[model samples]
Target: MGENSSPPDPVRSFSRLAVIVQLMMLAVVSAGWAISDGTAVAAAGTATAATAAVASVTTPPMGWASWNTFAAQINYNVIKAQTDAMVSSGMKDAGYQYVNIDEGWWQGTRDSAGNITVDTAEWPGGMKAIADYIHSKGLKAGIYTDAGRDGCGYYYPTGRPAAPGSGSEGHYDQDFLQFSRWGFDFVKVDWCGGNAEGLNSRNAYQAISDAITRASAQTGRPMVLSVCNWGNQSPWDWAPSMSTMWRTSGDIIYWGQSASMDRVLANFDSAQHPAAQSPGHYNDPDMLIVGMTGFSAAQNRTHMSLWALSGAPLLAGNKLTDMSADTKAILTNREVLAIDQDPLGGQGVKVAEDQTGRQVYSKVLSGTGRRAVLLLNRTTSAASITARWSDLGLTGSATVRNPWTGTDAGTFSGGYTTTVPAREAVLLTVTSGGGTSSPSPTPTPTPTASGTGAIRGVGSGRCLDVSGSSQANGAQAQIWDCNGQANQQWTSTASGELRVYGGKCLDVNNAGTADGTSVIIWDCNGQANQQWRLNSDGTITAVGANKCLDVPNNATANGTKLAIWSCNGGSNQRWTRS
Candidate 1:
């Protein structure tokens, strides 16, 4: 009996079949999306020509950068060592692609004709040689530069002396073109010099973006642009059109030290502009500080889970050449990584928080009624936390699986409850919540109507009014005292615009789709950006971007501006029409 096999178990066979079917469905759906966009996708399977050059960018980038650990001490030998270790240490196979040489790689050196030059001493075989080496290892190469005339190597200068004009201030096009010519696949433009010179963030980054575009065109290779302005000027509001990712906050950990949990939480909070994120665009929370010296194993787990939940770029900042087995295991956990790289590109939001420092967070996954839940306990004592189905927009019972330990935690009705250890977290994926889910508590189809009414905010108890009651085309929408005025009156038109003043439609300023895009009144032109849908969930959604009308920071003050953000079931997004 030990060596002989009986008939296959029906349950096991069914489970295997289900897995296969799910994988097939995913491949089919993903491919359809990419093909519809006229782009090549790996899931398409047959378009080997287009698929190879332009794989669908549906997730935040995952890679390793040198700044947090090696800082300005990096050189040709240093990069080679890390690049080799990235492959040998299993990081390369784990979807860690870019080996970024952040800052310090170059000093202010330009030859005749205003060309940026890398010192042969530091970059021995030239910058292109290292890029070729990284590509040889089947990974992408990332280079760094400052927006103005100085960089960290010139100001903060770690292990190197200050070198004037170490940035790309006067050479945006030339510098980016040089990076592309040298085979760099990514570029992180820092704001050190820009800030020093009081340069306008928008103007400066826009120039860099344009330069990168020109470079990509010239080289026939697109480079991922990382706008590293540290969230100043709220890059989430406009950077999506220019860069793949923008830093939402300052560095999680300094160049040479371990990061604190508070810093992690702060950075996480800063990057929660969920409305701004989409496929190929992300709000960066700086690089990962996992496995660093200061954090304990539990803390490390929490850090990873939070970042993964936020759909942040999973850039490793630890020295890969020497990592403990535990660190490697935590870093290489595929289940957690899958959440970070979910194809849907949804950001997790805080659904509930308590007095004892406990919180429940939820993220809507790709499949029906599937959700990712995080039970975080920030208190010093262990606490039992519950994830409510109502809060998650889920109904009835659901199956829960712990991604960290790879085990099913059974099913429960209404919600799931578990005791999270102090200062740690529990990450579980909930699926197949019994019955159906509604975007709201009661399912009501958005009816087509010509009726006019004053729209009030559920959270702020204020009326949505045109700022200053201005009739100008770009007048901003804001929450003000409820008054039966024409400015507060809105008609939900059949064509989807919430029209006021008869001819002006609520528009996304300049038809912007990024997070924090202002909600304003503009001349009705029947554009998708001006279209609105009054949903059953009590939220007004911008049809084109599929974002909700939201009060910035949930402010209850009068004159609080309104914007469109990714719907997160927040009261700030709920509105009432009467």
Candidate 2:
């Protein structure tokens, strides 16, 4: 990724003259456009991009995943013990029901029929028996797989006996049907092989969803699909349509160790897409690391508060068979759980950051004028953070109750201030203020200025090229070896269009407004789809469609088609203007 340059090609010296000539022309056109219309288009699409959520799970899911504690080192006895522990530990009644058996439960070996087969020795009664046992205990069963032919274990070897071809690549329908036949209530698909093979996350997940639908119809059982691609495709934008939840970041814990507050906060920051979340579809910040090796009770509270405020899934990633009272208390807090499971299903947003590491987060609850607030202290010392009434959409005095302590914190007008210990967060339930319904709003991404340079894909190291150098209205946008051609030269106009070929603007075909919508060259029209925001995160977000310009299949091959997708912070979506 350094310098983002290729070694000198044989024709590089000869092409410079032509590239400079074309570059000058593009600059002239851009200057004229800026002079004529930049001011007029400045306010276009100024409204919030979107506010609707997809229909999926009614609320963020509450469950347990094995990867956090046991990982691939699982067997029938291990899972059965965890399932038994779930009930005995009171987590089941406390709303932690799904007992997920993450990776390592299966070997790569499939039968002649290509059906997924588990380790029979480890699973005496087979996978269905374990699922039945979980169901018998009034808990749902969850399983894991990869999108590619080989699972994650093959690459990371995080757990016992890593195997290859454990993914459901060529057998999407067959494998999902098999899982449905086996009675799994939930499936969390990993992206190890998908990333390794450069698969288009949106297309891959969509195919898996379709397969699951077919399986569900055949089995008469609905299954929850959890997309765990580590935010590579900006899953939030499109995942809700196909999944109950989608992981918005990488693993929270470093595995086999105590979860760190820094990692927890990092994950929280990555999952903040309030506009993309809706009832039944939630952002997943990986599994909860509440009782992990290194977390203090206060640290656990901070972690829990962030996830609850975000309305993210509350999947415990610790060993359930054994628990300390403090761990149990932090995991089973009813009030915090209620906020996460609120029927309103609104994800929280940062209302204020008074200082560098002092942050205030607020989420609207189901009841009128009710809001859940988290005042987080990330500094080295305890800091006094204030939650303002106006920020929480409240007027005058408001009653603040301590949910963790289950006591009233009294009413105050305008704002409430409290001391939060270093690396800790204070969670409160505020109500009964002259409350309005508006949620705290954050500014949309600041647009990256159109510059005269090559827009090179970070992952592919290729330049955005217009296919065939066609001047037609429907010329396809693609990537090719950076040749400094007129097609590869783009002027990010002040008006927000990535313009090339003098007048044709980079556009979403037909203004399709969906993930994987292909990019094309079209006559410039001040349309929303043609407008884009160059983000600091290295993505070009389409202003109208609210999707990122993406390379199909994460491909580096010449002629790879360019499209728009949910912005997952993937390198394929990252572009360097040089």
Candidate 3:
């Protein structure tokens, strides 16, 4: 075998943000608390600013991590074995990259220059060799480290190990740079013991993120930086610009483990619902323990389905050397995996949540032709979960196919239902009829005395006002006279595209597909680039650009340049229903 073809060495241990406190904080501090002095008030204001100021950038990562199943028992050889299985088993071809080895791979001491190194005992040929193996197989290698000195002691959270380098930026930066040198493509930085001891846990997390971003720039390799802060401050709000994926929760374990599938489901709910996550950055609910000792193949299938539908990262935390054919099949399901790795990078949102406790996550996948929905049974008993055509907001007729079973879900009139096993999941792949496009029913333009049909603000009263115009293909959609133009009418279609009246489609102005780009109305060319959806929170996101439509200058002025910007819920980006 060639030098780069050598198998990686073997065993080690490993370890691994968001919401609510923010609202309470704003209410209590800004509205309730009053600082008596100017200096004190300024300090309070500054502290109120969060580190994760950006909106959710990427959808959750969709691949595997090693912590949940192997824990500290992971080794270099194990990563090699898993990467091989991932390829031979068809996972890499299906887009499951990021073969991350969690904790224990790092040495307890740094070099005199403050560079972190891999333990030679566990990784004899060095992380570079392991990375070579992974890359040779067409995959990415991820490493584990801590933002704090002594590694944050997260290896055993409750029984802190007194990690010597706990909360050390110098050490953290050194480790990141070293990983970059070793050809590592991803980093999962932990914050266990450092959470309580940092000058401010939030600031400390930001500091590490800044360090990683700098390292990524310095090394000239685009590494995925994942901050595992366990939802202390709202990572959804702050970490998107710095990292690719950040853990929204501590870790998810099933089959009598510390964290159960229930915890995983809850985290999924939080990420999809009122809170939003998007591409470039993701809401990592931790690694997958599916196909591990405790869960059945069916349960694991459901686990994988939910994560994929939610765009959560797919990290397999099982013993790969002993994986069964059924387990391998579940992990490498391409149709299901497509939902997770969809290029659009739009995170699925929760459309239904009932007290009977079932949840549905619907995502818009590629092909300009399909939709993916994961229906999960949160309860321990079997329950019937249905997807109605109306509920999905489909304009005309459609078909739902089971991606997992490879069978037509059997069309009913409006929707379809299947009994989901307790804690299990089902995957639905929806496509429009006959591959032909259908025009949604355009509302009749309600004209005023002036005869100008202007529709203002979509959804909330924030809409465009039109005066005296008929809907046409190239008609100028100006800031109207505000009588509600049906041409100004829009709907979030089942395909997840925000289709407008007439045949035009929403687009990112100039087609500059970068994070934080703005949006505009463009000719519909049946291309994914023209599709867009206004997220429930009123942020407008375009499909082709993979970014949110932003109001430039934060200006609400008429003809304000609508550009594609990152999906942060700022007043500049947040839209209201007209």
lDDT per residue as tens, model 3, 65-149: 7666655555678888888877777767766777887765654666677665556887878778888998998887887776655
Of the candidates numbered 2 and 3, which has the greater lDDT value? Answer: 2
- Candidate 1 local lDDT, 158-255, one digit each (tens): 77898789999989989989999999998899988886787878799889888877777788878888889876556766677567788866677775
Q: What stretches of model 2 exceed 4 Å from their correct place?
A: 1-56, 437-578
Better of 1 and 3 by lDDT: 1
What local distance difference test score does each model get?
A: 0.75, 0.74, 0.55
TM-scores, each model vs. reference: 0.69, 0.70, 0.62
RMSD of each: 14.3, 16.2, 20.5
Tens-digit lDDT track for model 2 on 1-578?
00000001112222222223222332333333355533211111111112111122467778888888886788999999988988998888889878888988887888888877777899987899999999999988998899999888888787666688889899999988888889898898998899788788889998998888888878887788888887654676678667788886667765566677756765676576564565566778788988889888888888999899888999998888787899999889899899898865667766565564577777767666788988987667999999887666667689999989899989998889999998789999999568653333334322233345579999999998999977578889999999876678675532356666434578889888889899998765546777777777788888778788899778999999999999899999989876
Worst 10 residues of 3 by lDDT: 1-10
Better of 1 and 2 by TM-score: 2
Model 3 misplaced stretches (Cα beyond 4 Å): 1-62, 152-163, 166-168, 199-202, 254-259, 273-275, 353-355, 367-369, 434-578
